[model samples]
Target chain A: MTEWEMVVGLEVHCELATATKLFCACPNAFGDEPNTNVCPVCLGLPGSLPVLNRHAVELAMRVGLALHCSVEPSIFHRKNYFYPDMPKDYQISQYDEPLNVGGRLDLPDGTRVGVTRAHLEEDTGKTTHVGGGGGRIHGADHSLVDYNRAGVPLVEIVSEPDIRSAEQAKAYVNELRAILVAIGASDARMEEGSLRIDANVSMRRAGAEVYGTRAEIKNLNSVRSLGRALEYEVRRQVGRLEAGEAVVQETRHWNEDEGRTSSMRSKEEAYDYRYFPEPDLVALAPSAEWLAGVRAVLPVLPSERRVDLARVAGVAETDAAVAAVVQQGLDGLVTAAVGAGADGRLALNRAANELAHATPPDAGAFAKVLRMEADGRLTATQAKGVLAELVSAGGDPEAIAAAKGFEALEGDVVAGAVDAAIAAHPGEWERYAGGEAKLAGFFVGKVMAATAGKADGKAVTALLRERLAGR
Target chain B: MALISRDDVAHVARLARLDLTEAELDQFAGQLAAVLEHAADVAALDTAGVPPTAHPFELVNVLRDDVAGPCLDRDEVLAMAPAAEDGRFRVPRILGEAP
Candidate 1:
C-alpha cells in the first residue's frame, strides 16, 4: 500500500477594526439594522466614489509586519463578478501588486508556515435566502440583502502550501489569530465572522515531489472545522485514487453538521474575475518613515511571550501549560510572580490552572501567596484558598491568609497530629517504616484531615521520611 | 482581421447578463475590434523608460481618516428599491451562492 500525504494552503480573511467603511464614511459595524449603515458609495449608487481609509491601510500593514512580510507599494483592482452580495457587481481588492508580499508565521510546535501574500480588500454585504428550506439558495423564493457589511475593509492573508497535515493547518490559524489580536489588527473571532478561512487541499504519494489536483474547501467557520474538512477531503481523494478514479479539481463546501465536504462548483464554472486596476483610488505607496512607525508600535507577539514565560518558569517552551498561560494572556502575571521570588513552576501551574478562571489579580498579591507556600507558612491547599480569595476580593495576601486562620499550625501541633495518625494507622505506619514508600500518602491524608486541610503535604512527607529513617 | 470575434462578444454579453440580439453581437464585436486596434497601436509604441499609468493624476496615498459620518436614510433608500421587505432589499431568486 502506498502512503499518502495531504498538502494544504489557507486563505484567511480578517475584517479590519476600523470605525468607517473602507471607501466611504458609512459605519463599519456588524449587526446594525439592515441597510442602516449604507451610504451612496457603499450602496454602489450612481456617481459615488470611494476614498481609501488611512487607518485601514495601517492596520493591514501591521499584520504584514507581524508576519515578517515586507510592506510594498500596492494598488487596488476591481475583481469583477456578478453577485448580489456586492452591490457594485465587483469587489475592490489587491491583485498583482499586493501590499504584503512574503512572510512567515512560526507555530508553537516550531513549524514555520510560509505566507504568500496578505492583501487589502473590501468585504461584501450579507445575503439571507429566506424562502428556501433551511435558508438555502437552492429552493429559495428570493434573497434578502443587507448592506451593513458592504465596503468593510478586510485583509486576505494567503498562505503557501507548506502545511502537510490537518494539525498544522489548525496551528497555523491559531497562531495567525493570536498575531492579529496582539497587533490590534482585528478581533479574530471566528464565531462572529470577523475571521474566515478557506483551505486548498490535495493528496499525493508520500515521496512524490510534483503536486496533485487540489480541491478548495470553503465555509470553514472555526479552526476545528478547518481540520475536519481537510481530513475528510483528503480521505475522499485517497479513496477515489485507490478505486482508479481521478480526483476532480473543484470547490467544496464544508458542512459542519454533516461532517463531510460536498461539491459546490467545479473549475469549469469558476468565474473569470476580469480584474482591472481600480481607477477611483490612487496608488498606495507608504513612506519608509510611516512603515517604521508601524513597526515600532507592534506589540510583543504570542510566540515571544510563550518563550519568555517558559524561560522564567523553568519549563519547556512546548509545554501545554505554557501555551495555555500565554493563550489566556496570563503569562505576564506568572512572570511577575516568579520575579517576586515565588517558585517558578508553582506560579506557572497555579496561574495556568486556577488564575485562568477568575479575574486577574494584582501580580504582587498573587506572588505573595505563592511565596507563603514556598516558605512553608501555608500548605498547598491553604495557599490555593488564599489565592482564590485574592482573585475574588482585592487585599494584602497576608491579611487574607491570617483572617482565614490559615496561619500555619504550630510545629508541636503538627507533630502531635503526625503521631496520632501513625497510632491510628499502625499497619500502614509499619509498612511505611519498613520502606513501603507508597504508604506515605495514607499518613499525609490523615494529617491533613486532623489539621483541617491546613497541613502542607510536602512538609508531612518530609516529617514521615525523617521519622522512618530514624526508626 | 478583427481582434475580437462575434462569439467573444456573445460570451461577454452572457456573463454580463445582457440579452443581446444576434445582430448586436456582430455589431459590437466589430466596434470592440476597432477599440482594441487603437489600444494595440498605442501598445506598439517604444517608450522603454515610461512607467505604466493607472490613473491620470500623479497623486499617491489619497486617504481619509477612519471616522464615520452620517448614513443615508434607510426608508428612503428602500423606497427606491423595486422590492423591499423587512428593512432589506428583496431581489429575485439568486441563481447560486455568492462567489
Candidate 2:
C-alpha cells in the first residue's frame, strides 16, 4: 500500500459590497423582493449598454492589493454559455488579461498560499428548481429565475495548488474571510452566499513530483462543507486508484445532507464557453494614483493583527487563543486592556474565552476587572461574573462588582473559611498534610463553596500549606 | 482546403443552442470557411509590432459613479417574458448547473 498525498486548490468568489451593479445602475443588494433590483442592463434587454461602476473597480483593487497582487491592465471577455440564470446568455469576465495577478496569501499557520489571479466578473441570477427531486435541476418541472443577484460585481480569487490537507484548506478560507471583512471588500458571510468556494482536489503518491487527475467540487456553502467535500473526494479518488481504476476529471456537487460528492457533469459534457473580448466595455487600466490611494487605505490585515496582538499579549502569534481573538475582531479590546496595565495573558484568555459569547465591554472597564483579579481584589470566578454583567449591560466595572456583591474577601474572612473547610473535610486535610499535594484542590473546592466563590484559590492554598507546615 | 468543416459548424450551432438544417449547416460551413480564409490572408501580413486590438475605439476607463438608479417595474418586465410566476421568470426545466 502506498501513502497518498492530497493536493488542493481553491476558487473563492466574493461579492463586492458596492451600491450598484458592476455594469449597470441596479442595486447590489441581497434578500429583496425577487426581481425588483433588476434593470434593463441586468435583465439583458435590447439596446441596454453596460457602463462600468467606478466603486466596483476600487473594491476589486482593494482585494487585489491586500493579497499583494500586482494590478494590471485588463479587458472583459464575453463568456458565451446558454443558461437561464444569465439573462444575457453570456458573462462578461476577464479572459487573458485580468486586473490582478501574481499574489500570495499567508495563512495563520504560516503556510503561504499562492494566489494565481483575482479577476472581476458579474454574478449570475439565482435559479430555483421547482418540483424536482430535492430541488435539483434533474427531474424538475420548471425553474424560476430571480435576477436580484445578477450583475453584482464579484472577484473570483483562484489559489495555487499549495494546500495539502483539509484543515489547511479551512484555515486558508478562514484567513481569507477575515482579510475580506477587515479590508471592507465584502461582508464574507458564507451562509448568505456573499462568499462562495469551490475546491479543486487531486491525489498523488507520496513524494511523487507529478500531479494526478483532479476533481473540482462545487456548492461548498461553508468552510465546514469545504473540508468535508475535500475529504470525501480524496477518499473516492484514492479508492479508485487503489482499485487499479482511473480517476475521471470532472465537476462534482457537494451534497451536504448525504455527506458525499456526486458527479455534476463529466468533462465530456462540459460546455465550450467561447470567450471573446466584450465589445461594449473598454479596457480597465487603473491609474497609478488610484492604485496608490487604495493601497494607502488598506487596513492592517488579520495575519498582521494576530502578530501585533500576540506581541502585546506576550504570547506566540501562532497561539490558538491569539488567533481566536484576532478572528473575532476582539484584538483591539485585548490590546487596550493590556495597555491599561492589565496582565497580557489574563486579558487575552478572558477575551478569547469569557467574552467569546458576550458583547465586548469597554476597554477601561475590562482592564479594571482584570486588574482586580490580578491584584487579589477579586477571585477568578468572581471576576468572570463581573465580566458577564459588564458585557451584558454597559457600566463601570467596579460598580458592577459592588452591585453583584463580589467584594474582596478580608484576610480574616478567607482564613475563617479555610479553617471551616479543613474542619469539615478532616480526612482530606489530613491526607493533604501527609504530603498528598493533590488534596489541595479538594480543600480549595470546599473553601470556595463555603465562601460563595469569594475566597481566592491561591489564598486558600497558601493557608493550607501554612497549616501543614505548622503540623 | 476549406478552413472549417461541416462538423465544426454543426458543433458550434449545438453550442449556441441553435437548430440548423442540414443544408444550412453545409452552407454556413462554406461561408465560415471563406471568412476564415480572409482572416488567414490578413494573418499573412508581416506587421509584427502592431498591438492586438480588442475594441475598435481607442477609449479606456469609460466608467460611471456607484450611485444607483431606478429599476424596471416588475409587472412590466415579467409581462414581457414568455412565462412568469411568483414574481419571477419561469423557464423550462434546466439541463445542468451553471457553468
Candidate 3:
C-alpha cells in the first residue's frame, strides 16, 4: 500500500562436487541409502580426525576468482553449534578467514552484486520433525535424522546487501550457479538440496536514513523461491511500517504455496556459536602456484564467455545469452565445434538455441551435447537427435547418432543430395522464381531432410540457389 | 564467566532441536564462550578498504557437456528414508507445511 526501498542480501550454501566429504572420505553424494555413504569422520564420532579435501578447497578458490574475489592466501575457522543433524555438534566452518572475500558478480541487467565472503563449511545431517496426533512438533513423539549428507563439503557465499529486488536475487543465484559450474566446483542443483539460499530482507521508507530491521528467510532451496520470499518480506515490512509498527527482527518461513513469509521465531542477535581453530585441521594457506594451476583450468565466466562467443563465434546477443544461461564456456564450445569442421556461428546456434530448446530441463547435459556437436563428427541435427536419444535411451551423442545412421555427410554425397532435392521439388521451385525469396528456407529444409543433415548446410544453400537461378 | 550462558545454550539447542542434558548444556556453555571470545579479534582487523571475503576460490564454471545420463533411481534414493508412507519421503509431522 506504501512505497518502500527493499534492502536484500543473500547467503548461498553450495555443495562442492568433490568425490569425498569436506573433511572425511565418506562420499559426498545424494540419492544413496541413508547412512550408507557415511563414516566415523562424518558421524562426528570421538577419536575421528578430519581430513581436508584439497579438491573442495581448489573449487572454492576457483569460484572466488570467477566472482572477482580477492582470494586470501589462507583461511579457516570453526562455527560452534549443537544439533541432531550435526554429528560433530560443532560445524567446522571459516569464521574469520574464508576462501574468498570481496567479489562482484555482474547480472545481465548491468547491475553488479557485491559478494561479502565465500567460506567453506561441512554440511550437517538432515532432520525430519515427527508430530503425533496433534499434527505439530510441539508435542511430537520424536524426530528422525539422516546423517548421510553430514560432513559434505560446502562453500557459503554471502552477498553484501547489494541486491534490490526479487529479480536481482534470482539473477545473483543464476550467475553464481554459472560460475560454480564453470569451475567444476558443485552441481549447484537446488532440488537435490545441493545448493541452498537464505535471504535477509529489510525495507525502509523512501526517505529513511538508516536501514529497517531485517528478517532472515531460512532454508530457501530454489532461486525462484528465494526471489518470491524476498518480494513477500519486503511488502510485509512496508505494511508494518505504514501501520506505525516496526519490522520485527526474526527468522521467517517462506510459505511458497501461500506466496508469503511468516515469522518462525524471534531473531537471535549474535548468540555465540563458539568458533575456534579446528584442532583436527591446521591453517591451510594455498600457494600462489597452486592457485595459478587452478586458474589455468578456470573456465571462463558466463559474462566473458557471452562476449567472446559474440565476437569470435559471431553469434547474436540472444544466442550468446542462451549459452551463458547454461554457463557452458562459449569459447570452448565454439572451439570444439570448429575443430570438428563445423562453423563457429553454426555451432553457437546449435549450442545456444537448438540444443537449449531440446534440453527441456537438464541444462547440464544439454551443454554437454553442444560440446559433442562442436567436435564436427555429429551434425547439429544429429546432436539434437542424440539429445532426444539421451532424453529417452541412455547413450552418448556420437554413439547414438552412429547407431541411428545419422552421421554427418561429407563433400560429394552432400552435393549429390543438394542436386537431387532441387530436381524433385518443382512447385516450390515456381514460388522461388516469383520473388518469394523466403522460399529458399523451404528448399534448404527439403534438401537437409532428404540428406539427413549429412551435407554441409552452406554448400547445400549455395548449390540450391545456383540451380534455382538456372531454372 | 562463559559468554554463552546455560539459558542461551539451552535456547539455541532448542531452536536447532538438540536434546541436551543439564551437564552437556553447562559444558557447551563454557566451550561456546571460549570460542566466541577468540573470535572477538575479527573486529580489530582494519578493513577500511579491505572487502569482506566471500569466496576464496576462482569463479570459473565447470561445465558438463549437455548430455543426459541416468540419474539416481527414485527407489534407491528414497529407500533409506526414515519414514516413507508412499512414494515420497515422510518424516514426523512437519513444523510447517512446505511453501
TM-score of chain B for predicted candidate 3: 0.72
Docking outcome class, model 1: high
DockQ of 1: 0.81
Best by DockQ: 2
* RMSD of each candidate relative to the true structure: 2.7, 2.5, 11.4
How does model 2 score on DockQ? 0.84
Order of the predicted models by DockQ, top scorer first: 2, 1, 3
The candidate, 2 or 3, that scores higher on lDDT is: 2
Quote the lDDT for B83 in model 1: 95
Ranking by lDDT: 2, 1, 3
Rank list by TM-score: 2, 1, 3
Kindly report which residue stretches of model 2 are placed more than 4 angstroms away from their true locations once superposed.
A268-271, A402-405, A410-430, A433-435, A449-452, A462-471, B21-23
Judging by TM-score, tell me the better candidate of 2 and 3.
2
> What proportion of true contacts does candidate 2 retain?
0.90
Report the lDDT tens digits of candidate 2 across residue range A1-471: 569999999999999999999999989999999999998899999999999999999999999999999999899999998889899999989988999999999977778999999999999999999998999988999999999999999999999999999999999999999899989999999989999999999999989999999989999999999999998998899999999999989999999999999998875442488888999999998999989999998999988898999999999888889988988889999999999999999999999999986788999999999999999998888899889988888898889888988888899998998888888888887787778989899888888888888788999999988888887
Model 3 chain B scores worst on lDDT over the 10 consecutive residues at B60-69
